[model samples]
Target: MAKAIRQIKQVDPAPEEWQAASLSAVVKAAAENGESLIKLLEIIKQLDGMGVLNAMEGLLQNRVDVAEIALGQLNQPTMYHVVKNGMNVFKFLGAIDPEQLQTILSGITSGFEKAAQSGGQESLWKLGKSMRSPEVKRSLAMMTGILAGMGEAMEQNHSLPEGGTDIG
Candidate 1:
């Protein structure tokens, strides 16, 4: 029988050999991805021409300082409210029906155009007569519904102080 193995010997490549291997692998990759490498080079050239590369390099070099400044700005009371309100607005929008919102926006745009054509010259009599129209009545009903919804939401969200009346 052969003698049992006592240890293992590992061979390590010299630094020059390692460099050559890495270069060969990179050359093979370049050959395989010639088109992508060309596009990447073009993008790099455009960014350099626009000074974006230099700006990015500077930003990276002072990342800690830039982060500190950003954090400091974000920690301000106004920024806190801005971020909070922005998130709330996003949530509110997310809850809306996009098609319904689009219809409403288009209606508002058309109303503005009509108003411009009228040049705000409509008499009180005409305005009063318009209230009898189905469109006006529908708009009024929508407004009333909105007000009712807002009242309900406000009552749910805000508590009255001790002995405070709802008359206000």
Candidate 2:
């Protein structure tokens, strides 16, 4: 029994070692450039824009399901934390009002219904493929530029003096 226990102990990692290994694995996984990562980011951005968190009480609950799907493709903990943090930021910024939240929920429900009626994942993938058009690209670029300008303005406002005196 002692010999068996020793063998088990030899195979099991120490807590600190395990943590380090996990962090290393996450870094390695995140280093990879893959379509799945792009898809994940796109999904997160869409969810943020659509105010998915405001529609759901426990926004992080679906994170486990997302992590499970991403297990082989991504570092589970990193993916989970990224999604959770993104959702938290969205919530913190007050991105969703009641009307917008309801619209997002309705859109999701309608999308699911349409997917069920047509096909399933294949149909959804086709829809996603269709959305990658030039018009969509232009719109995305414009929105990104607008948001970046807003962020820059906010930062400048916060950094400037109250009397707006020129430091130079």
Candidate 3:
């Protein structure tokens, strides 16, 4: 019984592991060329203008339908990564200007709203095609890692006892 319990409690990759894998993928993709890196930066900047953190919050909240709608605009793996990394970078920079941040956040929220209204996947595909930058690819990889980490964390949280108390 003890062994079975331990097995059930075993960690599957863990958030850190997912993050590492994603970051490694990004680094590998980026090492190919400088132009790709520049493209990635541009994509990230666009995502930054789009309010990544709030979207991530929606994702973390288990608002699946809403999150899916918002993520529609990020169907392209590269676009996904750029926005994800942009959010991470912005979060890390505590001194970012408030007004500028608000504007970016508003734009992102509006973009999500618009995507939700448009019932076509073609736009997302086209956006991806437009973001053919190496840097964007790398950022996407890293963002994938961050998302994996978030998933792991969510899973771990779900497996825990309620009220932050020990079950046993």
> TM-scores of all models?
0.83, 0.26, 0.21
Candidate 1 lDDT tens digits, 17-63: 99999999999999999999999999999999999999999999999
Worst lDDT window (10 residues) for model 1?
159-168
TM-score of 3: 0.21
Angstrom error of the Cα, residue 137, model 1: value is: 1.5
Q: So what's the TM-score on candidate 1? A: 0.83
What is the RMSD, in Å, between candidate 2 and the native fold over all Cα? 25.1
In model 1, the clashing pairs are none
lDDT of 3 by residue, 1-168 (tens): 344434356568989999999999888887877697899899887877898856777668878877787778679788979989999987867666788678657866875786787655557777788468774576577668867777677677795435533324
In order of TM-score, best first, we have 1, 2, 3
- Per TM-score, the best of the predicted structures is 1
Which of the numbered candidates is closest to the native, going by highest lDDT?
1
lDDT of each: 0.91, 0.72, 0.74
Tens-digit lDDT string for candidate 2 (52-78) = 855563536677776676675566677
In model 2, the Cα lDDT at residue 53 comes to: 51
